[model samples]
Structure formats: structure tokens, C-alpha cells
Target: MTGYVLRRVGVSLVVLLGLSFIVFLMLHTISDSPGRAVLGPKATEDAINAFNAANGYDRPVIVQYLAFLGNLLTGNLGRSYILNEDVSTLLWENAGRSAMLSLSALVLALCIAVPLGIAQAIRKNSFLDRAATSVSYLLYATPSFLIALLLIALLSQAIPLFPAEASQSSSPWAVFTDTRSMALPVLTLTITNLVVFSQYQRSSALEELGQDYIKVARAKGMPERMVITKHLLRNACIPLITLIGLQIPILLAGNLIVESVFNYPGLGLLFLNSLNREDYPVLLAYTLLGGVLTVAGNLVADILVARADRRIELTK
Candidate 1:
């Protein structure tokens, strides 16, 4: 397990390095002149050259990439030209907000999804199963932006249960204290994630129920509830775990739209601002951060799967 973890970490590092290089090359290529883009087109050639030299843009691409990699290893993510702030500081601040929102949404999704999924699986072709499946499919088919708009119209504009805009709360406690202000955005994310997760879980559970072990458990006169809970649910959870682990990055990325709609000050909002302002440092940092998170989530999922089922081999 240790060796497997080490190997995964090593691979993650290599992938991040490669991603950084690609982002650097793409940025330079897109901007035409990196220094001039940083300094503005109206700037004099000497000023541009000086800026390039100072930021090491005059260095070869490979050399610049190597320096960036070294700085990353030492936890120096560089400074943001647009924000005039350290990339790490911006990431840290925005990351917390994103984490809070996404984590809450994830928890809510699981809370709603698991029970519904289990019920649908157990009921099979009953009316409740059909209704749950239909609702899940409908939600899954709906675009997030549309759902956000619908929710805003219904919950915010008409019902007045939640505010259309998210409050700039510093912490989750603060946000929760003003739960009315935070409800819309969180609800948007929760509903969107719940649909996908519940469907996946339902499918997995149904498949697990058809397996030989489940039949044997039933034949052994195990109570239906016990068979479903102990035998089927545990095995069904493996696939759902993989999906949930992978969904972290998707949820984060999805927040780009969700945050914009609700005006939430999270990493997604920051990413949008960075793109609009062409803040290369923040953009690069966020990109790398997202990639790292995605890779790490998958690695954690692998470890969890191995732990849950000792027969699973990570070294493979």
C-alpha cells in the first residue's frame, strides 16, 4: 500500500509538471508576446523587455518551466499580476469558500441520494421506484444554469425562501448563521449533484442485487433488510465511491456557472475573474490546483477502495 501510494504521488507530480508546462506554453503562444501582454500593448519596447527580463520571460521555455517547477516544489506559486497578490494567498482564500460550498453540496447530495437509491433498488419496478428514477433522469437531463434559474425564480423571486445572491460570509459558520442568504446557491449545487449520484447508486445497487452472492444471501433465509443493507449495499457502494471521488473536480468546475449565477465569492468566481482580466498567475495557479485536486481525489478513492475491499490490489 505504501509503495502504491508513493507511486501514485510520483505520477501525480509528473502529471502536474507536464500540465504546468502545457499551460505555460499555451499562455505564451496565445498572448503572442508574454511581456507585452503583462505590461500592456501601449508600453514601450524597453519597458516590455525589462518586464520580460525581470520575470524571466527572456529565458528559453524549458528553462522557465524548470524554474516554475522548482518554485512549485518549494511552495512558491508566484505572484498575480492582475490582483497584485501572492497566488498562494488568493488560492487559500478562495479555496476555503469553494470547499465549504462544494463539501456541503456533496454531503447534501449523499444524504438525499443514498436513501432514495436504496429505496428504488429495493422496490425494483414499483411506482416509487419509477417516480424516483424519472425524477433523477429529469434532473440529470436539465442543465445546471437552467436549474439555477428555475430555482432562483421559484425559491428566491416568488417564494422568498432564499436570496438570489450569495452573501460574502467569511466562514461556513457565518454562512450558516445567515442560511437564508446561502440557500439558493447551495441548493442549486445540491440538486445538480444529487440527481447524478442517486442515479449511479441506483444502477449499481440494482446490479448488485442481481449478483449470485445476493441470491445466496436470500436463499440462506437472511432477512431482506439485512441482505440489502449488509450484503448488497456494501458491494454497491464501491462504484458509487469511485463516482463520488471523481465528481469532486466536476463539482468544483461546475461552480464556475453556479457561482456566476448566484454571485458567490469562491474559486469558481475567482477563476472567472482571472480569465476575464487575463491574470495569468492566478489562472495558472487555479488550473494546477484543480488538476492536483482531481488527481488527489482519485488517489484517495483508490486507497479507500483498497481499504474497503482487501481483495483489491492497488499495486496492480
Candidate 2:
């Protein structure tokens, strides 16, 4: 396991390096002048040139890339030209909020999905199973933003159960203290993710039920609950583990839309602001961070799947 983890980490680092370069090249290619983008069109040519020289934008692209890479190795993500703050600091502050929201939703979805799916699978071909399938399909077909808006209208505006939007406080941990503000955003994500998770869970559970072990356990006079809890559930969750690993990064991206609808102060809101301001450094760093998360999530998933199912080879 240790060797496998180390190998995966090494490969992930290489993939991240390539990803960074591609983002860097694309950012540079699209923008004619980073200096003008940062400094504005009103700045004099001399001022822009001076700004470029200071930032090493005047150097060859490869040279600048090497410098960027070196800085990245040492934990410097460069300064946000428009915000006049370190990109790393900005990301550190915002990413925590985004992570908190995404993780909360994921945990809630899993909790609801597991039991709901199991029940549906157990009652297959019944009215309950058909009803659940219909609801899951409806939820899955609905767009996230529309869901958020509806929740805000019903729960926030009409019912007055939760705030329509998150509090505008700048503190990253404010949501923890003010849990009410987190309700709408978390619910939006949960509703969006629930359909996918439940469907997968139902499919996996159904597959496990058809296996010979389930029949054997039942034939041995095991209780129905014991057969499911002791033998079937863990095996059924094996496929779900991989899906969860893939979902982590996707949730981050999906939260962008949800966050915007709720005005939640997370990476999504920050990313939108950066795009509006043409903040190239922040954009580059954020894009690179997404790559890192993708690689890390998949690696974690692979490790989890190995741990969950001993029949699978760890070396793979």
C-alpha cells in the first residue's frame, strides 16, 4: 500500500506539472498584454512596459514558465495583480468555505442515498420502488441553479426558514458560526447530488443482492437484516467508493453555480470576480488548483477502493 501510494503521488505530481504549463500557455496566448489587463488601458506604454519587466512578463514564455514553476515549488502562487494580494492567501481563505459547503452536501447526500437506495432495491417492483425512481429522475433532471432559486423562494422568502443568501461576512469560518446561512447552499448541493448517489447505490445494492453469497447467507438461516448489514452492504459500496472519489472534484465545480445563486462567498464567487477583473494570476492559479484536486481525488478513490475490496490488487 505504501509503495502504491508513493507511485501514485509521483505520477500525480508529473500530471500537475503538465497541467500547470498548459494553463499558463493558454492564459498567455489569450491575453495580448497581462500588464494592460492588470494596469488598465489608461496606463501609459512606459508604465505597462515597466510593469511587465518587473513581473518578468517581458521575458520569454519558457523562462517565465520556469520561474513560475520554481515559485510554485516553494509555495508561492504569485500575487493577484488586480487584488494586490498573494494568490495563495486568497485561495486559502476561499477554498475552505467552498470545501466546507461541498463536503457537507456530500455527507448529507450519502446518508440519505444509502438507506433510500437500499430500501428501493429491497422493494423492487413495488409501488415504493417506482415512486422513488420517479422522484430521483425528477430531481436529476432539474438544474442546480433553478433548484437554488426555488429553495430560496420557498424556504427563505415564503417560509422564512433560512436566509435567502449567505451572510456577506468576509470571514471564511463565518458559515460555521452562522449555520443558518449555510442551509440553502448546502441543500441546493444535496438535492443536486442526491439523485446521482441514490441511483448508483440502488444499482450496486441490486447487483450485490443477485450474488451467490446473498443466497447462501439466506439459506444458512441468516436474518434478512444480517445478510444485508454483515455481508451485502460493504460489497455493494465498492463501486460507490469509486463514484465518490470522482464526485469530490465535480462537486467543487458544481458548487460554483450553486454558490453564485446563493451569493455564498467561496472559490466560485472569487473565481467569478477574478474573471470580471481579468486577474490572470488568480485565474491561472485557480485552474491549476482544480487539476491538483482532480488528481488527488482520483488517487484517494483508488486507495479507498483497494482498502474496501481485498479481492482487488493494490498494485494496479
Candidate 3:
């Protein structure tokens, strides 16, 4: 397991390096003169040249990229030209809120999905199964922003049960203390994730039920509940371990739309603002962080799958 983990980490580093270069090239391509963009449209050509030279942007692209990698190794993400703030500081301040929101939605969706999906599988062809299927379909079809809007209209404006905006307080922990404001955005992401998770759960459970071990457990006079819970549930959930790992980045991406709708103060909102302003430092740093998370999530998933199923060999 240790060897496998070390190997994965090495591979992840390579992937992140490639990702960084690609994003760097794209951002540079998008903006012909980043210094000019940072300085505004009215800035004189001489001023732009001075600014670029002062910031080392006048250097070759490969040299700039090498310098960035060196700074990254030293934990010094560059200063944001537009915001005039440290990119690392901006990330630190906003990452927590996005992490908490994504985590809350994931946990809630998993809790609901496991039971609901199991029930659907157990009561297949019944009214409960059909109803759940219909609801999942509806949720899957709707965009997250539209769902956020619908939730705001019904729960925020029409009834006023929860606040329309999620970022009511400066502290990220406020999401926990101020459930009223936090509920809508969490629910928006949760509803979208639930549809995917529940469908996977139901399918996995149904497949497990058809396995020979499940029938053997039942034939051995095991209680129906035990047969399902002890023999089936573990195996059914194996697939979801990998699914959960894959969904982490997707949830964060969903935050881009969901946070925009709810005016939530998170990485998603910061990313959008930086993109609009052409803040290259922040954009590049964010892209790096995102690549790290994607690699880490998949690695964790592989570890979890090994633990969940003893038949799987970790060293392989």
C-alpha cells in the first residue's frame, strides 16, 4: 500500500505540472498583454512595458513559467495584479467556505441517497420506487442555478424560511451557526448530487441483490434485514466509494453556478471575479489547487476501494 501510494503521488506531481503549464499557456493566450489588462485600457504603451518589465513579464514565457514553479515550491504564490493581494491569502480566505459548502452537501446527499436507493431496490416495481425514479429524473434534468432560483423563490421570497443569499457573515463557520442562510445553497448542491448518487446507489444495490452470496445469505435463514444490511449493503456501497471521489471536483465546479446564484462568498465567486478581471496569478494558483484536488481525490478513492473490498489488492 505504501509503495502504491508513493507511486501515485509521483504520478500526481507529473499530472499537476502538465496541468499548470497548459493553464498558464491558455491564460496567456486569452490575454495578449496581461500588464495592459491589469493597468486598464487607457494606460500608455510605455507604462505597459514598464509594468511588464517590473513584474518580469517581459521575460520569455518558459523563463516566467520556471520562476513560477520555483516560487510555488517555496509556497509563494504570486501577488494578484488586479486585487493587489497575495494569491495564497485570497485562496486561504475563501477556500474554507467552498470546502464546507461542498462537504455539507456531499454528506447530506449520501445520507439520503443510501437509504432511499436501498429502499427503491428492495421495493422494485412498487409505487415508492416509481416515485423516487420520477423525482430523480426531474432533479437530474434541472440545472443547479435554476434549482437555486426555484428554491429562492419558494423558500426565500414567497415563504421567507431561509435567506436568499448564503454569505450573511464574514466567517465561514457562520454556515453552521446560521443554518437559515446556509440551507438554500447546500440544498441546491445536495439536490443535484442526490440525483446522481441515488441512481448509482440503486443500481449497485440491485446488482448486489442478484449476486449468489445474497441468495446464500437468505437461504442460510438469515433475517431479511441482516441479509440486506450485512451481506448486501457493504458490497453495494463499494462502487460509490469511487463515485464519491470522482464527484468532489464536480461539486466544486457546481459551486461556480450555485455560488453565483446565492451570492455565496467562496472560491467559485473569487474564481469568477478573477477571471473577469484577468487576474492571472489567482487564476493560475486556482488551477493548480484544482489539479491537486482532482489527483488527491482519485488517489483517496483507490485507497478506499482497497479497504472496502478485501478481494482487491492494493499493491496491484
Candidate 4:
């Protein structure tokens, strides 16, 4: 287990390194430069060159990349050229909001989806199953961003029940205290993710139902509830754990669209803003943070799966 963990951690470090390189490459490959963006269109060539030199953009790309990586190791993410704000400060502030929104949505989706999945598996081919399957297919096929827009229009604009923007609160706790403002964004994520989660979990349960252990449990006079809960549901939920981990990153990305639509001040929106301004420092920081999150999520999933299934070895 120790070796397995060490291996995974090594791979995760390599992944983050690769991701950092990609982000650095993207910063230069694009036609637009931070110097130009900061100096504005009317600025002369000399001013742009001066800005670039001052910011070390004049350095060899390899030197700059190494320096960037070193800075990251030392917890120095640099400053946003346009706003003159520390990238780390901005990331921490915005990341908290995004984490709150994403986690709330994830919890809400899991609560509804798991039970709905179990019900569908229990009553396979029945009216509830058919109806739910149809709806799940419909929802899972639809785009999350499109649904987010519609929710904003109907719930925020038409009914005026919730605030359109999700950035009303500074922190997660504050978000709940200002629950009305959070209603629309949370609902939008819950709806979209519930469809995805229910479909995946229902399939996992159905697969478990076909397994021989389920039949053996039932044949041994296990109560229907006990058989389903202990014999089937527990195993079925293992796959869902991995799916949950995978969805964390997806949810973070999805928040870009949702937050943008609602004018929320989360990391997604901040990333978008940085993209618009060609803020390489801020973008690089987010890329690293995202890579770390993905690595951490996959590691957590692996540990959970290992815990769930003792027969399975942790090593590759």
C-alpha cells in the first residue's frame, strides 16, 4: 500500500509538471502578449518592449519556465500584470467560492441521484424506471451551460425568486446565510449533475444485480432490503465514488459557464477574466491549482475504491 501510494504520488507530480509546461507554452504560442495587453493598443513598440523586459518576458522561454516552476514550489505565483494583484490571493479568494458552489451541487446531486438510481434498479422496467430513464437520458444529453442559462432566465429574471449572480457571498458559510442568492446556481448544477449521476449509478447497480453474489444472497433467505443494501448497494456505490471524484474537476469547469451567466465571482469567472486580459500569471496559477485538484481527487477515489473492495490490490 505504501509503494502504491508513492507511485501514485509520483505520477501525480509528473502530471502537474506536464500541465505546467503546457500552460507555459500556451502563454507564448498565442499571438497576444501580456505586454501588449497591459500597455494597450496605442502604446508604442518601445513601451511594449520595455514592459516585456521589465517582466522578464525578454528572458529565454526555458529560463522563464524553470523560474515559474521554482516560484510555484516556493508558493510564489507571481502577480497579475494588468490588475497588479497577487495571483495567489486572487486564486484563494475565488477558489473558495467555486469550491462551495461545486461541493453544494455535488452533494445535492448525489443525494437525489443515488436513491433515484436504486429505485430504478429495484423497479426495473416499471413505470418509475421507464419515466426516470427517459428523463435522465434527456437531461444527460442536454448541455449544462444551456440549462444554466435557462435557469437564470426563468428563476432569476422571470420569477425573480433568487439572485442571478452567485457571487453575493464572500465565503461558503456566507453563501448559505445568503441562501436566496445561491438558490438559482445551486439548483442549476443539481439538475444537470443529477441526471449524469443517476444514469451512471443506475447502470452500476444493474450490473451488480447480474452478479452471482446478489443471487446467492437472495437464495440464502436474505431479506430483500438487506440483500439490496448490504449485498448490492454497497458494491454498486464503489464505482460511483470514482465518478464523484471525476466530476469534481468537471464541476469546476462547468462553474465557468454557470458563474459567467450569473455574473458570479468564482475561480471560473476569474479564469475567464484572466483569459480575456491575457494574464499569463493568473492563468498559470489556475492551471497548476486545477492539476493539483485533479491529482488529489483521483488519489482520493483510488483510496476509497481500495477501501470498498479489499480483494483488489492498490498497486498497478
Candidate 5:
């Protein structure tokens, strides 16, 4: 496991390097020198040139890429051009809030999805099963932004349960104490994941139920409830580990939309604000980090699947 983890980390680093380069190239290709954007139109050409040289943007693209990789090795993520703050600091502050919201939603989703899935799987084609399937499909097919809108309309505007939009609360850990600011955003993510994960869980449970071990356990006079819990669910939930790990990107993408809709101050909101301001440093760093996180999530999923099922070989 140690060797496997080390290998995965090495590979992730390489991929992250390539990802950063690509994001750097893309940002430069689309937007001109940060100098002009910074110095404004009235600034003289010499001033702009001085700004570029001072910032190291005057170097060749490859040179800039090398510098980026070097800085990354030393744990420097460059300063935000617009905000004049360390990109890493900004990310640390905001990413924690995003992670908190995402984690809360994940917990809520699992609590609801697991039981519902097991029940549906146990019942097969019963009315309850069919209803669950229909509901899951309906939600899975709906866009997250649309879900947010519906939630705002029904829960916020009509019922006035949660605030219509989240306040710009910068306190990362405050959501745990203040349920009011978190309810709508967390609900939006929970509903979305509940729809997606329930389907996966149901299918996994059904597959596990049909396995030979389940029959053997039942034939050995194991109680029905015991068989379901001790044997069936234990095996059935393995796939869910992988599913959650692999779905990290989808979860973050959902965060983008949900945060935007709810005015939640997270990475999505930060990304939007950066785009509006044409803040190249923040934008590129965020995009690069996003790729890194996606790859890291997949690596974790692979590790988890291997750990949960010995038949799966990590080295292979």
C-alpha cells in the first residue's frame, strides 16, 4: 500500500505539472500580458514593459512554465494580480469553505441514499422501487442550476425556510454553527448527489444480492436482516467508495453552479469573480488546482477500490 501510494503520488505530480503548463498556455493564449491589464490603457509602453519584466511575464512561455513548476516545488502559488494576495492563501481561505459545504452535502447524501438504495434493491420491482427509480431519474436528469432555482423558489421564496441567498460569510467553520447560511447551499448539493449516488448504490446492491455468497449465507440459516446487513451491505457499499472518489470532479462542477446560484462564497464564486476581473494569476492557479484535485480524487478512488477488494491489483 505504501508503494502504491508513492507511485500514485509521483504520477499525480507529473500530471499536475502538465496540467499547470496547459492552463498557463491557455490563459496566455486567450489574454494578453497581465501588464497591460494591470497598468491600464493610459500607462506608457515603458511602464507596461517594466511591469511585465518585474513580474517575469516578459520571459518566454516555456521559461514561465519552468518558473511555475519551480515555484510549485517550493510551495509558492504566485500572488493574485488583482487582489495583491497570495493565491495559495486565498485558496486556503475559500477552499476550506467550499470543502465544508461539499462535505456536509456528502454526509447528508449518504444518509439518505444508502437506506433508500438498499430498500429499493431488496424490493426489486415493487411500487416503492419504481417510485424511487423514477424520482432518481428525474433528479439525475435535471441540471444543478435548475435544481438551485427550484429550491430557491420553493424553499426560500415560498416557504422562507432558508435564506434566499447565502450571505458572504468568510468564516470557514461558521457554517457548522449557523445552519441558516448553509441550509440552501448544502441542500442543493445533497439533493444532487442523492439522485446520482442512489442509482449507483441500488445497482451495486442488486449485483451483490445476486452473488453466490448471499445465497450461501441465506442457506446457512443466517437471519434475513443479518444477511442483508453483515454480508450484503458490506459488499454492496464497496462500489460506493469508488463512486464517491471518482465523482469528485462532478461534485466540484456542481459546486460551481450551486455556489453561483446561491451566492455562496466558495471556489465557484471565486472563479466567477476572477473571470470578471480578468485576474490571470488567480484564474490560472484555480484551474490548475482544479485539475490537480480531480486527478488526486481519481487516485484516491483507485486506492480505495484496491483496498476494499483484494481481487483488484494496484500494481497491475
Candidate 6:
């Protein structure tokens, strides 16, 4: 297991390096001049040149890439052009909030999805199952932004349960503690995630129920509860584990829309602000951090899947 973890870490690092290169190249290609973009085209030519020279942007692409990598390895993410703050510091401050929001949504999703999915599978073709299927499909087909808006309209506007704007909270803790302010965003994400997870769980559970072991367990007169919990659910969750791993990154990315709709002060909102301000340092930092997180999440999923099913080989 240790060796497998080490190998995964090494691979993640390599993948992150490649991702950084791609992000850098894409950023460079999209903008005519990094210095001009940062300092503005109205700046004097000498000022632009000076800024470029100071930032090492005037160097060859390879040299700049090497310098960027070196700085990244040393824990330096550079300064944000718009915020005039260290990019690392800004990320550190915002990442926790985003993590909190996403993690809460994930928990809510699992709480609602797993049991409902299992029940639906157990009662296949029944009205309850049909209802579950219809709801899941509806949520899966709906846009996240639309969901957020609908939630805001219903819960925040009409019902007046949750606050419409999440940004009014004084701090991260305040947002978490104040259900009225946090409920809409959390619900939006939970609903979105729940729809997908429940559908996957339902499909996996139905497949596992048809397996020979399930038949044998039933034949042996195992209680329905034991048959489903100890045998069926255990094996059925393998694919769901992988789905969870993949969902981490998607959930994080999707938070952008959720955060925007609710005016939440998280990385998603920060990312949007950075884009609008053309804050390259922040944008690049967020992009690279997201890539690293994605790779790490996949590695964790691989290990967990292997642990859950001994037949799965990590080295292979």
C-alpha cells in the first residue's frame, strides 16, 4: 500500500507538471502581451518593457517555464495583479471556505442519495421507483445555474427561509452557522450531486442484485436486510467509489456557478473575479491547484477501490 501510494504521488506530480505547462501555454497564447494585459495597454512602452523584464516574461518560453516551475516547487505562487496580494495567501484564505461548502454538499448528497437509491432498486418498477427515476432524471437534465436560481426564488424569495445573497455573511463561520444564508447554495449543490449519485447507485445496486452470490445468499435464507447490506450493497458500491473520486473535481468546478448565484465568498467567486480582472497569477494558481486536486482525488479513488475489492491490483 505504501509503495502504491508513493507511485501515485509520483504520477500525480508528473501530471501536475504537464498541466502547468498547458495552462501556461494557453494563457500566453490567448493574450497578446502578458505585461500589457497586466499593466494595461495605456501604459508607456518603457513601463511595459520594465514590467515584463521584472516578471521574467521577456525571457524565452522555456526559460520562463523553468522559472515558473522552480518558483512553484519552492511554494511561491507569485502576486496577483488585481488583488495586489500573494496568490498563495489568497488561495489559502479562500480554499477552506470552498472546501467547506463542497464537502457539506457532498455529505448532504450522500445522505439523500444512497438510501433512496437502494430503496428504489429494492422496489424496482414500483411507483416509488418510478418517482425516484423521474426526479433523478429531471435534476440531471437541469442546468446547475437554473437550479440555483429556482432555489433562490423559492426558498429565499417566496419562503424567505434562506438569504438570497451569501456574501452578506461576516465570515466563513458565519455562513456555516447561519442556515438561512447558506441553505440555498448548499441545496443547489446537494440536489445536483444527489441526482447523479442516486442514479448511479440505483443502477449498480440493480446489477449486484442479479449476481449469483445474491441468489445464493437468498437461497440460504439470509434475512433481506443482511442480504442487501452485507452482500449486495458492499459489492454494488465499487463503481460508486470511482464515481465519487471523479465527482470531487466536478463538484469543485461546479461550485463556480453555485457560488456565483449565491454570491458566496469562495474560490469559485474568486476565480470569476480573477477572470474579470485579468488576474493571471491568481487564475494560473487556481487552475494549477485544481489540477493537483483532481490528480490527488483520482489517486485516492484508485486506492480506495483497490482496498474495497482485493481482486483489483494497484500495480497493474
The per-candidate count of clashes, in order, stands at 0, 0, 0, 0, 0, 0
User: How do all the candidates rank in terms of lDDT, highest first?
Assistant: 3, 2, 5, 6, 1, 4
Per-candidate RMSD vs. true structure?
1.8, 1.7, 1.4, 1.6, 1.7, 1.5
**lDDT score for candidate 1 against the true structure:** 0.84
| Candidate 2 structure quality by residue, lDDT tens digits, 199-247 | 9999999999999999999999999999989988888888988898889
The top-ranked prediction according to TM-score is 3
Which residue segments of model 1 deviate by more than 4 Å?
none
- In model 4, the runs with Cα more than 4 Å from the true position are none
Candidate 3, residues 1-316, lDDT tens digits: the string is: 6676677778878988888888888877777898888999999999999999999989998998899889988999999988889999999999889989999999999999999999999999899999999999998999898999999999999998988988657687866988888999999999999999999999999999999999898889999999888988888999999999899888878988988888888999999999899888898888778778888898889878977775565447
Clash total of candidate 4: 0
- Segments in model 6 whose C-alpha atoms lie over 4 Å from true places: none
TM-score of each: 0.94, 0.94, 0.96, 0.95, 0.94, 0.96
Query: Where is model 3 poorest over a 10-residue stretch in terms of lDDT?
Result: 307-316
Model 1 lDDT tens row, 187-250: 8899999998888888989999889999999999999989978988889889888888799889
| Displacement of the residue 163 alpha carbon in candidate 1, Å | 0.9
- Candidate 2 lands at a TM-score of 0.94
- The better-scoring model by TM-score among 3 and 6 is 3
Query: Model 3 segments beyond 4 Å from truth?
Result: none
Worst 10 residues of 2 by lDDT: 307-316
Q: Write the per-residue lDDT of candidate 6 for residues 1-316, one digit (tens) a residue.
A: 6677677778988888899999988876776676887888699899989988988888898898888889999999999977889999998888878888889899989988888888999999999999989988988999999999898888878988767887555366654677777888888899999999998999999998889999999999999999988998888888888888888888879889998888888899999999887888888888887788788789889889888876666444
Model 2 / residue 80 / CA error / Å: 0.8
